[model samples]
Target: MLPTVILPGYLESADVYLPLQQALTALGTPTTTVPLRKRDWLPTLGGRSMIPILRQLDRTVSAALVDNQAAQINLIGHSAGGWISRIYLGDIPYTIHGDVTEAEQLWNAKAKVANLITLGTPHISGERWTKKNLDFVNDNYPGAKHPEVRYVCVAGKSIYGEKKLGQWLAYSSYQQTCGEGNTWGDGITAIKAAHLTGAINIEIEGVKHSPRTPGIWYGSPAVLPQWTGYLS
Candidate 1:
């Protein structure tokens, strides 16, 4: 089995995914997470650039390859990490901030990835703050762009976005993510926004977006079985 690397979401530290790493290990799949702390995301706070995060991801991938003695590995990116993983897998130069030099063009990771599983990732976004990065990802590497790597997009259907007070947050998040608010989502990303056109899309009925949220999430022990089957 190919070793797996878990890329946590924006502002999330690697420690938050320990439960998930342990679960995957118990299933016989060697797993590791990019050693990222919340402080590491501070530099990219204003949508400036994700180059720093990508660099950490590259190092972790390299280490996973060497340590596991595997030619390729599986990547499981949650939330924003998912789209960032898309950028990592592409050959196109990511030029959002216009700071990526030729020497920094080492993020073309498709050759080292066997499968990619995204959890409640907003593949599309309408918010102005995130437009530049999202645009670059969509324009350069569209849905399921790489045929060699399997793409499995998972969305949770625990919350229905509504204008009411109880669901207003979900409603607003869905609107910002996919330009639609009155839809089903995982409390942060709408199902439509989380899915890719040519990927194997899945929707879990009672899951939330993150582990911190009430109820089961993508990384939850119960939910892992729902999508981990696609890892190999």
Candidate 2:
């Protein structure tokens, strides 16, 4: 089996995903995560560009390929990282700091991908900063449309809406992400947006966005049975 490369989300560091990485590694598939720090977002968020993030991901991909000595590897992206992986797959075009001269091709990265899995990734979003980029990804490469790659989208079903006191925070986050409050989600990404049309979509009953709190997440040992089947 090929090794798996894990990518972090927006403003996220690779350390937070250690639980999931350790879990996957223990399951027979060696895994490596992008060493992303908060500063990695500085060039993108501050400059209104995505080049920095994409380039960093590309480097991580290269490293994974070298370390595993395999022609292809699997990708497990969480949240924004999932959609960004789409951009890396080369279906859409992107520029750095709005300069067309800085355009890049992700074909090299695409050549190294085997399976791509997304955990609580918002396939659609309402925020302007992400809407344009996500729209491009969804429009060009919706779901598991790529013939060479198997796409799997995972969603959580722990929070329903803002009605209950316990759901207020999730509700607010869901509304901001999916532009709707009265829906199901994993406290941050709505289930509706987390699923894709052609990909293998799955929903977990008690998992949250990440393993950040009182319970296990999509990457935990308890939830591994839910989506790990697609790792190959």
Candidate 3:
């Protein structure tokens, strides 16, 4: 099987995904985490342009392809990494905010991508930093409609954040991500937003947004059975 490249979420470093990478390796899918960090993403985040980060992801993809010596590789992206992977898979145009320059194509889609698995990714975002970029992703790629690649979306159902302490943290995150907090979600992302219309959608009962001390996220060993099958 081709090795899987794991992409971390926003403001997260590559090391944060080590637990999940270990789990996937044990499950027979060799994995690698993209060496990404918050400092590397600061430019794109502040400038509202995803060009730099997308380039970084592409470099990782190229390295994975060389390391595994395969024509195609599996992509596992968490949170914003998921949508960013979509942009990486095609020749999509992107522009910097407040810049009058013409939009540029970040990736040329020459790399072969076999499967794409997303964990608690908020495909839709209401925040200004991601809204326009996500709009481009949703409009062009739109769900798992890509003809060549298999798309799998994994969602968490542990915290809805409707009231109390959960409301303050998880609910606020949900509201920021999807514009509502009275629904079932993984505290950071909503199930409905995490899934694409034509993709393989899965909902885990107690998964959180990421691996925590007492609970597991999508890549934790406890929940490997839920979405590992798609790695093939």
**Which parts of model 2 are misplaced by more than 4 Å?**
96-104
How far in Å is the alpha carbon of 138 misplaced in model 3?
Answer: 1.2
Which ten contiguous residues of candidate 3 have the minimum total lDDT?
Answer: 96-105
Show where candidate 3 strays beyond 4 Å: 95-105
Candidate 3 per-residue C-alpha lDDT over 1-232 given as tens digits, one digit per residue, 9 for 90 to 100: 7888888887788887887788788877778888887698887764276766776777777787888787888998898888888887765555535442345445555357889999999998887768888888888778885768889999999887776854568777788778887888887898878989889999999888876536777877678888888886
TM-score of 3: 0.90
Q: What tens-digit string does per-residue lDDT give for candidate 1 at 1-232?
A: 8899999999999998999998998898899999999999998887778998999999999999999889999999999999999999999887768777757875789999999999999999998878888899998889999999999999999999999988999999999999989999999999999999999999999999997777899988888889999978
Checking candidate 3 for backbone clashes, the offending pairs are none
Best-fitting candidate, measured by TM-score? 1
Residue range 113-199, candidate 2, lDDT tens digits = 888899989888877777667767777776766878888999998878786889988888788777889999888899988988888
Against the unseen true structure, what C-alpha lDDT does each candidate score?
0.92, 0.81, 0.79
Deviation of model 2 at 150, angstroms: 0.5
What is the TM-score of each predicted model, taking all chains together? 0.98, 0.91, 0.90
What order do you get sorting by TM-score, best first?
A: 1, 2, 3
Clashing pairs in 1: none
Position 38, candidate 2: lDDT: 82
In order of listing, the candidates' clash counts read 0, 0, 0
